[model samples]
Each structure stands twice: as structure tokens, then as C-alpha cells.
Target: MKSSGSSFYDRIYRLVGMIPPGRVATYGQIARLAGRCSPRNVGYAMSSVPPDSPVPWHRVINSRGRISVRSDGEPCDAQRQMLRSEGIEFGPGGTVDLSVFGWRGPAGEVSNDEQW
Candidate 1:
């Protein structure tokens, strides 16, 4: 599906919202949840998140559980801080350990409401 407007973006946002605190999901995971074919679409949807939006955009990371962007400026630092505050551990190389902190979808069977 083509995510061309606010409704499409809203769907992506709502999916992101389902991600629990301290657990991170990959962009591909979000895309799959949103019924999107490409992970790039998930990134695009996140980039368009409004300033006042409550979606947990920071909880969405790459497949390897790494932040898409390195910690550089205030925003990046803030993102890292937020994750850390959630008890997400980072390796010595500043990479999150996916095996430990990554979310593997919902437990057991997928719920009908969770289906994209």
C-alpha cells in the first residue's frame, strides 16, 4: 500500500506505538506490522512524525538493534539517553545487543487486531 497521506502515516505511527518500553523493534518489523513491503517505507513514515506526536519513534531501530544514526548531536544523544533510561544496554562499541533487547513480535500467536 502507498502511504501517501496522514492516514497512512498514522497507521505506521499506531504500529510503532504498540512497541513496549525497554524493548525495541526493527524498521523491518514496523514495516511488516504496517503491511508495508519495504523497511524504507517505515523509515519514511518515522521521519514524517510530527513534533508533538507520541509515537515511540526512538524504539524503532535497525535489524541489528543499532540506532540508524550514530550519536552525534543533541537529538541523537537524546535518543540514546532515552533508550538507556529504558534499561536498554549498549555494547562497548555503542551498539545495542539485539539478542537481549530486541522485540520478537508478540508472544505466541498474533492477535487479529495486531494483523496489518
Candidate 2:
């Protein structure tokens, strides 16, 4: 059987690959989708993917709709620039408007909240 690490990375990459140029997904969202991984694990996979990866690591943000800075103090300006180039505008506080750009999978809205 394939190792969980390999499978986890593969699954994370697959979902990340689906994020369109101007859209974004959260590490938490990706972790939930990948099932067995955590947000930290998703972050690790994002950082570990090969340089030529088609996963679009720049598109994965935090649940607050802001890009999470790298652990090495590497600023996310390049990622913000890349998103801007794709027509994704950021607010004054550097947060994306999730209501407008969030991709909630095939079913649309991705939440388990009850309609009370």
C-alpha cells in the first residue's frame, strides 16, 4: 500500500490544482478535504511540493482569507502580486473577499451549519 505521506501529498496537490487562477482555498479547507491530514500537514505539503509543481501553492490562504506568511519569514508579497495579476483584489487589510472568490467545491457552499 502507498504510504500515507505520499497519498496525503497527492490528495492535497490534486485539490490545490483545481483552484482557478483568481480563486483561493484555505489550508484548513484543504485539510478537511484531504481527510487524514491537518492544516499544518497541508502547509507542509504546500511548501514541500516540487518547484515545478502545478499545484499553485500561492493560492492557498488561511481561513481568514489572508495569505499565511512562510515559516522562514519569507513575505507573501509575491503571492499577493501573483493573485493581483490574476485579477484578485485584496482589501486594505490584505484579505480577500471570500464571499466573492471562495470556491466551496462541486456543491457550492461548503459548510455543515444547520439552517435554523
TM-score of 1: 0.79
Displacement of residue 21 (Cα, Å) in model 2 is: 2.1
RMSD of each: 4.3, 6.5
What global local distance difference test value does model 2 have? 0.81
Clashing pairs in 2: none
Q: What digit string (tens of lDDT, one per residue) describes model 2 on residues 1-116?
A: 44536666888997888777778888988898888658999989998989887889888988898888888776579999998898889999899987787767634542455221
- Error in Å for residue 46 of model 2: 0.6
Best by TM-score: 2
Per-model TM-score on C-alpha atoms: 0.79, 0.81
Steric overlap count per candidate: 0, 0
Stretches of candidate 2 exceeding 4 Å from the true structure: 1-5, 106-116
After best superposition, candidate 1 residue 43: deviation in angstroms? 0.6
lDDT of each: 0.79, 0.81
